[model samples]
Target: MSIFVRLLEAIGIASASAPPIASRPAPVGPIMAYNALDLSDPGLLEMMRDGRIGVSGLSVNERQALRNSTFFRAMNLIAGSIGKLPIHLMRRNGKLTEKASEHPLFNVLHRKPNDYQTASRFKSYMQLAALLDGSAYALKIKSRGAVRQLIPLARRSVKPQLSDDFVLTFRYTRPNGTVVTLQADDVFHFSTPLSLDGLNGVSLLDVAADTLGLTIKAQQAAARLLTKGTMARGALQTEATLGEEAIAHLKQSLAEGYAGANAEHDWLILEEGLKANAFGYNAKDSQLIELMKREAEEVSRFTGAPRPLLMFDETSWGSGVRELGLFLVTYCLMDWFVIWEEAIWMWLLTPEEQKTFYAKFNEGALLRGSLKDQADFFKAALGPNGAWLEPNEVRESFDRNPIEGGEGLPRSGTTAAAIAQADKPDDKEGSENGA
Candidate 1:
């Protein structure tokens, strides 16, 4: 621990030893409940507007509004590469015979699913990201150029930053070889960046968040490689804490909201379990990511697209549900901070720089935040008796909460919770499904 602390001190990062303490105290993610804040808060509304979040690249407020919007949910469904409707659903003589039924408990969940194909999911997501008016945008993104300069810098081996946002940043280590440290500026697009050199700053928080995200993505890929064909083991474990934190945060919001029910003081920042910012990764996200990567690779093999993934920006799709007197907006940054790191690393990032970027950019934030919405959907479906729900009843209550605002996700919170508890401090899950 002392040697690790010293290395981080070399990178001009001093708060190295204390980040863990700060993370533990963070409030959990909020729950969806009807309140006026849904309509009043510009950030929440912005998330409702666009279907995707640009993270640092776009306006945070607008992204917030876009998250609560129903339009994005409709779009996300149709963005699949092949087609929207399941192949089985589109059989030769299959007709739209049966009208989709609405759930009695929640009126919103009964709505018909939408499927609009997007031109380029990522770039279209970039359009949504354009909403961020401040810095975090850039041009002439020649990854090759950044790698050329940064890779050599890694070999020199200066003092490590020791921040939680490190690869070696987050329970990482120096492989027994020449070290190469590379920082990603792509996620750090600050419009009209200070020097006009397109260079913005890297906060310890941002770096930490990025590391978590990268860890999830890379670890997911690794898991896919490690497990032949089995349910994702790693994801289940990490989700335990992730779910607990989320529930705790939401419950706090409920208390605040209930306490001030008659007053205008409607919202407060829910404590986040994720320690880092945008690229933050918790143990649970990594576990699931391990499973997701294999799912992604399987898609690659099946589609022959080299690598293909059915991406869902659940966190950005929409906000909390609002009804007659109740207006709920679960303000969770549960959206994927960065998806497809392997593709990003292989195609966008250089070979040499892949190590650092993979561990850094994505790890800055947690991969899974959409769990809040799933929980919300369950609460909504459970009527006013969410607390009394039984195990199967819980499953039944969630006839299926679509991802964020889309299709049915993993079916039950149990599955999601199990995965969240799986991520380790080092983000290294045991090889349970060692095929």
Candidate 2:
């Protein structure tokens, strides 16, 4: 009977048999029509203004926060680093493990998850959503009792519901006004580490909204200073008082003569005894730059990204860059990797399969050093003193095809003849008598 119920009914969510609002669980809260309804509707606008609808009341908008250069760079750096890495489905056989390439889900994870998106693009999109919106979701399209495709769902459009029986479901409102209720097993959900109730994750953006607001405000102030600040190249001053009409005319004349890129080098003509005074960079301007830098540092700290990776500092080509890369992997990416792996086990793999199968993000690419350093590492791995890595295994790391007889580990000071001679049993009497 209420406007909210009517709106829900109009969107094909509420029906005659639907339970009354008071009877529903309290913690589920009101179903927010986030961008699902016509926002231009006056009734909707009224509800939003009156706080009847739970539209995002973020102090800083998520999209606007991304517009900041430092925030964008930090997000891109973290998301891209996770995206570019290869995620594989691996099976453990005792102490040995190998890529489960033959599994149906393996291709979905490694190469293509769906028809429209590659693994990299899909992972990147999910990572961005998780970082920005606190959670990410994908509907698992299954075929023949196995997952076939993963369709991404908008974070805002999907509402999570948990019942008293500990069962979970998702009420997803699509763009076309259709509402679909999905089971917990049918959706792949990834949440941020900061979860209070253990069912939903807290948004990092929302948690750091005040800081992001300051960053956005600082950026806007800098823009205003550049466009309308008194630190311009020069300004006109007059000793004689002038009428409003005269002042308007002088302002128009100055703008027409020297406003844009075309008038940058044009000479200003002095009229009515007006004098021009040049301006230089002042302490205030320097302070603004420092303020922006400090805000960037704050954002970097929130994202757990190193300042160097965010382009705040200059890292040399070899070791400096390598160390930073390692730091990023250890501090920032490792947790994300574990999150994805555990989520995959929970949502993608079956109970029996989870015992032997697992997902892993191969971060070797990000942690790789220079060519020489890699060579030395591989050399040490394949060394004779208790060689743990096979020649073919090292080649596989380099993306080279395995060669014949490369599976076995090599030993130093050992040749085919030496091996054959060593294999032969020696007669002690023959050796001592020189027979």
Candidate 3:
């Protein structure tokens, strides 16, 4: 079997038997049609041939890319951010909105998505898969016309097919090597915004292969350097021309006596008036730190994560933590939120429910600041002057239970009873005020 086929099998994707290229049908719809000759499809051919190998000669598939620290950190930042936030199924009643707790999807999205995974964990896994593979798929197991459980599928295991009439089908390979074709409504697909054919999302790993490859190479170089005790290659100079035997003996001596970490500090013992002349650049000369920083920035740019969040000491868009966090939410996570919300509406909500019910990630928690700042914000929200939020609303934000009579917005200072008696309006003024 080919390495590509092995890789596919390793990831639970079963490769189909190939027919002759001449007998294959023409490309149709937005999906890339594959002929018996995989080489006919440029994208698939590239993946099979190059396996996303970079200029640095490093393979940069999703798993390989995640091995880089910067890439892993960025993925974790995005996935964790989406995971920790609460998602709600909200219902709209004219101008008012409230959580649709009675909806079947409410518990599946907010509390537990499946018997084994909590909502947070499922979201994190899905987000991570989407970020890595450019698309994430989950089976929407329904009961009584309502989705009851969501089972995530391996990205490689599911193949999407679009018919000429715009019907979508998913061919999924189970762990037991069984292939089952499912309709559009049976699957929940979330893809990144960048797409050429609309039906499938492009993988970020493939797009940023060169950058990530260089990063992995740089990391390997650093590891090798550390293993060699930060040593640089040098030449042993001698006035006398060395014979082949002498050179071999000298090379062996260097390798056995002074090559690795244990012999790093050992003094070189040279004979016959030989001198050590350093030639190649050391880690400092090569600017490894600067290279790593550039790679980190590249990862941040590609993953839409702030550099500061990746543990870079430099200041990002804002100086304060709250501003930086806001930057992350607004720039990095908002698109993902929209993707999830729209996907939910598309796959989970019925046509009648779509008009009134929608999904939303409550990002208010991520935007919150320190305790003092939160207190001031709640106070202002519940203040008497044009009070917009009830006391119970503020308490709910803090995860506190509502007290009796805390549901109403208190217009204390603005009330007629609180107004000064001297400032009280006369009969005509009072009538106008009441009007």
**lDDT tens per residue, model 3, 199-303:** 778777877888998888888878888897547577778999888998899889988998789997799999878999987777788788789889878877888
Mark the 10 consecutive residues where model 3 has the least summed lDDT: 30-39
Write one digit per residue (lDDT tens) for candidate 1, span 136-206: 22122333354211111111122223344543211111434233343444221222111223232222122
User: Per-residue lDDT of 367-429 in model 2, one digit per residue for the tens?
Assistant: 677787787676666655666778788888988999887777777664422343344355345
| Best-first order by TM-score | 3, 2, 1
Off by over 4 Å in 3: 1-51, 228-281, 414-435
Weakest ten-residue segment in model 1 by summed lDDT: 324-333
Alpha-carbon lDDT of model 1: 0.31
Q: How does each model score on lDDT?
A: 0.31, 0.79, 0.80
Q: For each candidate, C-alpha RMSD in Å? A: 31.0, 9.9, 9.5
Q: Please provide TM-scores, in order, for all candidate models, with all chains considered together.
A: 0.15, 0.73, 0.75
Identify the candidate with maximal TM-score: 3
